[model samples]
Target: MPPSLRVSQRRLRPGSRVAIVSPSFGAPGLFPHVHDLAMQRLQSELQLIPVEYSTTRQVGATPRERAADLNAAFSDASIEAIMATIGGDDQITVLPFLDSDMIAKNPKPFFGYSDNTNLLNYLWNLGISSYHGGSTMAHVARPGGLHPLSTSSLCAALFSGGDFELYPVSEFSEDEQNWNDAAWSDPNGPPPSPLQTSAGWHWHQPDRVITGPSWGGNLEILDWNLAANRWIRNNPADYSGCVLLLETSEEMPSAAYVFRTLRNAGERGLLAQFPAVLIARPKASNIEIQPTPEQRMQYRQEQREAILKAFAYYNPDTMIVFDVDFGHTDPQWILPYGGMITVNGPQRQIIAHFG
Candidate 1:
């Protein structure tokens, strides 16, 4: 394996300065209350200073404008790391304007997921590793407080570069509180969305261990990137031995769509490159479509089946673990993008190697 496949040893120390830019969406502009609280936590809890760019709070900022913020952040020597405020749908548009040469010359740890996957893959292709799950507005400014799991994993990713074992959440939530609602601005903030008892992770073909650099994110965004055929390596073999990380966004794509997306990758001979796969707990419900508890279970089961079918057809020997919390789900775990991840099938465990 190439040495650049893993993240560099660079890490943020206490009092480090991090650039908080909205490379995807100017969410801080949309909800200043949520953004402000997140900034406060970034300082008080993490003991890091937050630096915002011009486009950080400018709603409807152009793709070039967003890309410029990212370029500026990466070029700035004082900024130890860069983090996105939130993910949005149009991040793909910003890719064309990014100054890859400038970014490659001055690499910094980036943190975000969902649409941020586009940037993550771009960085990965450049041999720069990033965090796959984080959003200043979503996690740091979470109502009530940050999830213990999120705080721990994020802290590990940011400061401690070591092997970190992932634990399943016994209870989790996928519902979202309306950020536009007045409750978000209240002194107490809005109550946390209810959590459902986790069914625990389900492992398939737990016969061996597979450890390699991580790849893939938000399945939907990956499909878009795959179709663009720009960021992904031209040869599928470039991904051989990598662990696949997949999760669905709040858009809640249907089982058929998920199957088709994976199937597309399979047809391209890309899916077979991964020896192991870690799937995030699917977001079973959204604010618009709240399924009953029973229905939610059914939905998850169907999606699981779709995934198994696709992988079974493409690579029967591949190991799969379902329902690991990350991405759109509550209490997200910050996994390393392009960093080492060990999927131990026999032990039924997942460990992320930070840095």
Candidate 2:
């Protein structure tokens, strides 16, 4: 591991307090019932207390206001950790307002994904490790209770500190409930989107093993960061030996867009820095964009090919794993950003170290 990268050893006990802040869109404000359910689960399921901030449910809060909430969370001694209510597109705007020095001095495990990738990468550049997964509103407040796999991996990331082996789930779904529909708040509301059987993980160049700190997040967000040259290291070698964590969002970007985004990274001399990459199962169908089953399968295939094409151009020797359940996918695994991950290609296994 690089000396610059720092992993927190602080683990949450049952009674610890976790601050829930909305550093992005205030989804909690829009769906307080779902957000309340998530808060309740934080106590009933995890046996931990959830503390919300001023902007936690404040829709249309400015970027500075969001940053203020985050800063407060970091500075508060009683708060052992911080978790976002949900992710939004404008989190990048909040980045410049963050108090990096203060956050670096008071590092804690941050848990959120999608647009939260902006904050995750910010913390990474400061050498602080965080968890990459969906927000409380999106995951914990899931209509049909939490997915067993999500709970299993989240527990590992939150309370346990060890090498937890990543597992392949039998079934998964990308469907989301319409929050505006009152049924979503009903106990007997419609069941979650139909579950599809997983084909399991696909491995490429499984001839060697690579263990390193994981980086990267939603592909689109990474592209945004790259375009802005925000917190990314100027010298790509700073990422040498790191495992790249890649995933798409609910937007369902085309294979061409995925290829171009990665191509941009490769053009920046970025892709060659990593020896291994873990691509999350792309979210094929969403509430807005519903495609046929065959189309969904075809989408994933073309996406995989696009990724391989990018790697083939920049780093052909890279070990690649596709459809690891993380990011936008349900039954997701919470990966440690900037923490150690072992990509055992020959063993066809992955182990994430939640330090």
Candidate 3:
């Protein structure tokens, strides 16, 4: 695909109906209180009506139902765009059921991340562009309150056009603030935490400005794609000049595991194709294993070394930026898959130029 192919942005007028579907897992009605609040915010704040599907709130529905809902949303002239409720495991199952022709004929903005990586890649393969950030149940329907940064980024993604610059949001929260909690409906929560000072974009080869159509998603999920051979190009050279964006999920795999995955990419001759890679901030905390501040910092450092080692062995010229606020983090920035991204390594600046 050409790095400069422009996907026309949809102008969302007031009362525009946006279909809400669960292509992965269903958690919206499970936490109806929070889901309803998010719906209200979308209608009132953004002036977009939320259109729900039958299986959208039903957990354990067949992948066919999920795929059907996706087709229905795209086919309906009344529905202008599609947004996922949240990400879940096993979205790969829905792949076989999707109609690529239908999606191609009715290309509209599709948004989600994590497991939704499967669908996003599928859309890209069909020559349609999709956004990789924010979900209804997870980001918009947080228990305590919606993050202002999340709302702002999502709005721009849904309604805006032209060149937009993304910066790190000042405050971020990754804790699981429950929508089921009674106190959450209070419309207020604790004050936003202060954002820590960031060590800005880091560069590897500082001589060039690489521009390409963006690709990639949650690192672990891409592993699953490798096994399934769903949307990946058979030849690594086909990905040449593309900016690769990656992130780790809350699963928090060990640094060794991360290295092994990178090694697999190298073995497949996939590492040398991209001129630049944007690493999303790893989600370090989980209910199963909560590490101390010192341990968390060590984890990030070790992961960084692993990435550097793999790059050195395979693609020494690839530029890298660590800990970008995307993927499984609060105040996540929206990224366009198969859209133009410019990485100026010498100046240490990264800019995503979307349609």
Candidate 4:
């Protein structure tokens, strides 16, 4: 890791330019209204100007073109930061075309998650820290303005550089909000569905505090990395002392599938490398699935057990916390990928350093 990477971390002043690129699915091209809403909020709330690249709104762009757009954003002297518009299923395909040397030479904060995990991991491997949340369409363009939790956390990551504690939102919604219709564009949209009271963090091996640089991303994406033989370290020992960040996508793979994925990681000697693990709240259901409440509860419980089963078999002494709201959940926190993270088990808390 180069000390120069930290030199790349700069707090953006209001009206500073941020590059908006779609390295994943080009949802922004399909829903221009949604993209416009997000751009408006970035300008009005953050006072930042969004400069869209050619491939940003290009739905059928080749991987090379999107990778070229990313290269352009990182290398540009005027662009202070980079943000993904949304996550897609095939972002893994874009990894090979990225220039690791160029990205490392011109490191800057990158913000995104889900399928954008591919990009986050790519930056992490280059020894550059990035943000693991805040896709423009899903978060910045959220109904009824930005959610308070997401806004506050994102602001801290963008404007300041230090240790920030992460906490549970008092309530979070899994509302059946439709994004394509006019209902989504209305600032005075109908009230969000009732928020479920948080169950709070569930812990295992809550004893010592472990602090280190963070690693890991979406579980499905990590699995893809392993299968593709890309990005993942050849030596498991390379991950020692790092905090692992894991989350599921809306596809909502079955508990058995999640277990199998983790089990494969463990078998590959990956799970034992980290002393702390953060699992995002499993998106128990989606509009396509529309599971019953009882079914949702059972699904989450089973998934939790599956994760615990994997850890127990591999790294039993690790500090594990479940249901973190950073992935596929409402009011997401923007975690700093490859940045310092403190997991205080005895105190039951997690702190991350954006710088």
Per-residue error for 230 in candidate 3, Å, reads 1.6
Q: What value does the lDDT take at residue 17 in candidate 2? A: 96
Against the reference, the lDDT scores of all candidates come to 0.89, 0.89, 0.78, 0.85
Q: Per-residue lDDT for 299 in model 1?
A: 89
lDDT of 2 by residue, 56-120 (tens): 99999999999999999999989998899888899999989988898899989999999999999
Return the candidate ranking by lDDT, descending: 1, 2, 4, 3
* Tens-digit lDDT string for candidate 3 (193-231): 334445544556667888888888988889889877778
**Which candidate do you rate higher for TM-score, 2 or 4?**
2
Candidate 1's residue-wise lDDT over 1-355, tens digit each? 3237534467788899999999887888978989998998899889999999999999999999999999899989999989999999989999899998888878788999999999999999888888998789988988888778999999999898799999888988888889888887775468889978988899999889999999899999999998988687868898999999999988899999999999999999898899999999999887799999999889899999999999999999999999998878888999989889999998888999884
Please give, for residues 1-355, the per-residue lDDT of candidate 4 as tens digits. 2122242757988978999999988888888888888998899889999999998998988888999999899999999999999999888888788887888789888899999989888887777888899999888987677888888889988887777899977777765566766786575344565577778888888899998888888999988988998888888887888899999988888889999999999998888988999999888767667777788789889999999999999999888999989998787988888888898999999998776
Candidate 2 at 304: error in angstroms? 0.6
TM-score, structure 3 vs. true: 0.93
List TM-score per model, in order: 0.97, 0.97, 0.93, 0.96
Task: List where candidate 4 sits over 4 angstroms from the true fold.
Answer: 1-7, 188-190
Give model 3 RMSD, 1 decimal: 2.2
